[model samples]
Target: MALSVGDATLAALAGVAIRRKPARSGAVHRTGAPVLRDSVEAGTFEEAFFAVPAKGETDRLLHVARKTLDAARRLRRDARLGAKILTTSERVIARLTGSAVRVYEEILTLARLNRGRVFPSYDYLADATGLGRATIGRALAILEAIGFLVRQRRFNRVAGQGPGPRYEQTSNAYRPLLPERVLSYLPRWLRPAPLPEDEVQRYADREADTRYMLKSLSCRELAEATVSGSLGKILAKLGAAVDRREREAQIDPQPLTDSYNKAQTVLA
Candidate 1:
């Protein structure tokens, strides 16, 4: 993720900005002594504080900054997947098409770096994502509708006072919304139950037939094959269509359950 010119300027400003540390407890005590003694004590304190660094504080802050940056980057990546475009509305599994997802991800990356300030222009997005201008526009529209972003009109004074809009991420609520995980699974409400071993074998066979039928078979043949499969096998096949759904359901459900249980305990 290369920083934009605006973002680079902001970063430079933040880097040089000095924040005042709170007054130390012994400042008065040290200053109250003889001037020579105070000077000697100040030098000693400076030597102790700056000369020999506390490895633990330095290491901890570094770790935290690294983690925060990583998390921010991941959130930006996932925000694109959250846009919810380019898939069939039907329950059948389908991969997302086009570079819209990539564009959305880049938008998120820019937003993260700029503290939610994303330039919403099609050209900006297309340039960042290498997507076509039209594709970027479509993706931006979809993203705006999904509540992940908000568009605000601003006057571009540099361009002689015409109104231009900027896109900003409204949902700074970070979660582990990985794009690979999102695209690979169905929603929890639509997910099917796990199949038994016998049903799994039957479903595997049916899946093979489904793939074959997908390659120009007649509608009647495909219908007949679908109908002839056992109910359990059909369900299992559907479940397998989005392999990560079960895992996501499992992973997502427990924390919620635990939270409910804890609340109930408090009430009781």
Candidate 2:
């Protein structure tokens, strides 16, 4: 018998089991059932589960789904484009100085976090990016010199007037540079073949559906449930859109032009 969506969802939530065939080759393989795949499938199925709701809830679900799908589609497009740019930048930096590529990524991560108002201390960044504190400090200095980061000093008059310095991006620094980087640096082998627009649209639709399922819950409840469940990653992805927009607004147009010019020179 075919299971209803609700039934399948509940069973998945309760933890379904699947049998795995043993591998052969004279290897001492441990015989045991794998549960990770079932768990993942269950999570995916749960995101699609929606119980019959009151009159207006169906329309609300559809609206949220549409918005989520739109955001997801744009995200996928941006990510693919961004990856291409970064790959190209990596190759250019690698050729210049083998170590520069990693430093460049560190700068990018810092810039991303800054957009989210998440300024990590030197120690925090050193631990997170696995770069030495001195290296991270040097990279931050370079980023500021290159117009990727701007240091602002604010005085806290209420608290004895001490000077506090914070880093900020010049303005759309990443977005334009990313597209240029993708077009210039992507080695032919590493470039993903162009995906059909229809396939991209399908992914967008699926993302939207998943988002609608989450949106059905109240915001506070959803936050609590997400922390306790497997939906944290999804929530994080959804939240990134806001940060991306803020970063785009602050990106400096001139550096992007310079980065594009530099990329063209490297490609040439």
Note the residue pairs that clash in candidate 1.
none
Indicate the worst ten consecutive residues by lDDT in candidate 2: 169-178
* Model 1 ranges off by over 4 Å: 1-98, 157-268
Q: Write the per-residue lDDT of candidate 1 for residues 64-131, one digit (tens) a residue.
A: 32333343344445556774433332111122223534655665555445443444556666777888
Off by over 4 Å in 2: 1-98, 102-133, 140-183, 225-268
TM-scores of all predicted structures = 0.25, 0.25
lDDT of 1 at 137: 63
lDDT of 2 at 174: 22
Best by lDDT: 2
> Which digits, one per residue and each the tens of the lDDT, describe model 2 over residues 1-268?
6777887787798786332343233332233322222122222222223122344433332233233334334445655677533343343222222122344444344444443232345676677678888876675554444332333321111222335432221211121012222232334443346789999999999999989988875544465456534466566555566556656777844477888999999999
Error of 2 at 174 (Å): 19
